[model samples]
Target chain A: MNVFVIGLGLIGGSMALDIKTSNKEANIVGFDANEAHMEEAVSIGFIDRKGTLEDAKEADVVIVSIPVNVSLEVIPKVLDIVKDDTLVFDVGSTKANICTALENHPKRRNFLAAHPIAGTEFSGPKAAIRGLYTGKTNIVCEVEKTAFKLQERGFKIFNDLGMRIRYMDPKAHDKHIAYVSHLSHISSFMLGKTVIEKEKNERDIFDMAGSGFESTVRLAKSSPAMWSPIFEQNKENVIETLEEYIANLQKFKELMQQDDYNAIYKEMADTNRIKEILKGISIKTS
Target chain B: MNVFVIGLGLIGGSMALDIKTSNKEANIVGFDANEAHMEEAVSIGFIDRKGTLEDAKEADVVIVSIPVNVSLEVIPKVLDIVKDDTLVFDVGSTKANICTALENHPKRRNFLAAHPIAGTEFSGPKAAIRGLYTGKTNIVCEVEKTAFKLQERGFKIFNDLGMRIRYMDPKAHDKHIAYVSHLSHISSFMLGKTVIEKEKNERDIFDMAGSGFESTVRLAKSSPAMWSPIFEQNKENVIETLEEYIANLQKFKELMQQDDYNAIYKEMADTNRIKEILKGISIKTS
Candidate 1:
């Protein structure tokens, strides 16, 4: 199969690597708005060659793995140019906006909207690594809207990549992703900001911070070029999660003010359930 | 050296493991206020044998690695009982309060106040792992207060464990640790509490959260029994850092409320300096 991948950043570049691994004959072509990223992907052997919009349109399969807002503009164009037999899909984080943009498109049936629940804080073609998608969840929203043949091909591709397939409504995907994914990044961003702003000695924070701080602040290193627009496109749900987060922080702060060690202990102990939750997460991801 | 380790949890047990590896002839005896923790340490080979208060006073070296608040009560007693030849030290997070407790004690010269800037979110004897302290920073607080001979031995032991040592005053250690270490834990804990409270489906959160969420919320899995008292013992500094953290959250929230994507982008980009800072950190620790 000849596949053309748009936006050869972390996700697209990673999937390109996996696709080549799964099927040796799969020819993967990469394209990115940042020509440098596309060149890096090819030079690093993440893809067979670089391609154009026309090249993508004519390929056996087209996968758009660009940022969410970029997807709104580019995915529909890809759909317009795609051949009758082409299988198209996107691996965007937010789903509703892109799904809405394509609702009435004549080739809507050729496109599958997916959110692969896999990524790291790092970004760009340089951040690509092998086995990024294996055993992770692949969420396909509005699956029924995509043509039956497209859906079957999409499922087969994801399964070949060793991804667990899940079907969900577009709105539910956005709402849940806001809580599970976007909010975590925002929380980490704020944490890094607060520390950098408050701690006069950056060297000290670095020296004294343990692996726990490293883990908690890791997401702060994510690409702003990538994320700011995500929060913008998914404004309603992201803000709601942020507000709930602030409320919780305030409550915890009040408990600190009251010197309520008992309540603080109970709250933290309750949250330790995340240990079990993360254990479950690692098993699935592992 | 016959070393008596009080409070055989993560730090103590880990240090004991390194002590054994570094000096096979060194007899590492364990004593914990928690009898089960003591038994578990011995059973798991974290120590040579369980010991009593007499054994601690008789040992050539004594290490206290209990929770911060308990250290206040136990440390002074250990100081009172230490023989003139015993070199005693602590691995508590907060140093000021413990230093204050030892200020007028006659055995102060024998006690070196230390905080090994190393730990994971998990706790207990089971959490002890070999090489846990390797390539990590060990902050020696009020080094001048320890007898010259004891200070040299303390630095030598930490060096033998593959740790880089830094010296600072007790007050500064507490204040800086509040921002770098304690505050990170609170941010993570509140994040977990907020998600656990707001997101209705625990299973869904577990299923959907990516490695980013796992990293950001990892500290929420830490033992409250360990942290709440660190917050209490260093109440003033912890509260100040928390206030600054809250203020940062509010500023970010206001930006989101105004839909200021530009400011959001700039703020996160600024905080992304943490990437370089963490790079420097790994270089120092590695």
Candidate 2:
């Protein structure tokens, strides 16, 4: 079984590691634009060898895990070279554009649009770890477009990697992801910016910051290289979530200004139900 | 050592647990407006017994850990009854209001204004855990107002509990805390509100939510009873931080609307410095 992993970063490297673990005969080939990352992935023993896009021709499976913008240009070319019977998938955050771009492709049946929603604030080949997808949700968009045999192949890999699968249309995936994922990144970035601006004047302000502040601002440390494209691809939905978030913040400030402690207290108390809503979901924080 | 813990919640109860661990001769007398909490604290072995306000006369140390509004009312009476040798301190989030309210009290020398920057999202006696303050910063405000002997006594307890002490003025503490602590709470609460509102129209929104969203919204689970008073007392500084935060959000939204991906990328890349700022600080997520 020949598996070619493009963009040997967190997601791709991790997927290769897990696939190697599950299938003893699997040969993992890594291709990253960064020469250092491909070398690191091989040195780290996650990838069996470093290969070029030309090597993807013989692959039984090819996984594309680059930034969304780069994936837009690279995935169609990957599809252009892979065998008819080969299973190919791209694990990018935004799926609508890639799915729409590949709608009329000759090998469309061989391609699957998947988003394994699992990651840390860190990135790169060294950031990859085994079992990264375990117990995480993998939203597969436009599954109907993929061939039945390839869908089975993708599900086999997802199951072996210990991920729960949810299917949705590509457009709906982008809209919903804006609320749950993209908006949080924007919120964290702005919070970090606001505090950094104030920290210039007040040097010791961080001494007063507790675990709560740390938790709320953790996403501010995510890689801009991976996230900027996601926000761009999902601009309309991201903008909508940001507007709603800003309005909610303004309303809270108004309540405080009016000395309406009752409303302020009630607002937080209402949001406290998030504890119950988020109950079985465990977030790893190191 | 007759140590009276005036509230059997997360902070006070945890303090009692640690103090008793350090001082074998110490007797922890628990008191809470909630009778169930005092009883539970005693039964849980964090406190040796339940006590009333009259017991404060015999207290060698009084640790006040209640809502700031309640502390304003109860702390004065605790000082009036405590012995001249007793060390009385309140561990609330806001400092300036309580410090000013007791500025000219007859027994002001017996009081030390301190804010221990530690806690999880949970509350109550059941939420109490050992070593909650270990390796955490304890900001002591208005230390000069307290008697030199009482300040030494307070420092001894902080040292025994493995806490790092930093002296700060009450007004400065409040203002800085608004940026690092209060503002983050407002952001988390508003994020949770925005998502919950959207969840009304889209039921499966949270299904796509990952660890990033979970971490960013964790503070929304905090107790409103405790936070409302902190925000009210620190209103002016809190309002300032909110305005700055809202402006930053608006600016980010404008950049998105203008389709300036370069600026968006730079904004997040700049804020990634938070990883360095928070390197040695560990926040307990579970």
On lDDT, the leading prediction is 2
For each candidate, give its TM-score against the true structure: 0.97, 0.98
Relative to the true structure, candidate 1 reaches a TM of 0.97
RMSD of each: 1.4, 1.7
Per residue, candidate 2 scores C-alpha lDDT tens digits across A1-286 of 8899999988998898899899989988989999999889999999999999897899989999999999998888889999998999999999899999999989899999999989988899999999888989999998988999999998999999999999999999999999888999999999999999988887867767778888899999999999999999999999999999999999999999999999999999999988976774664211
Candidate 1 residue lDDT tens string, A64-97: 9888888899988888888898998999888889
Clashes per model (N, Cα, C within 3 A): 0, 0
**Which ranges in model 1 have alpha carbons more than 4 Å from their true place?**
A200-203, B201-203
TM-score of 2: 0.98
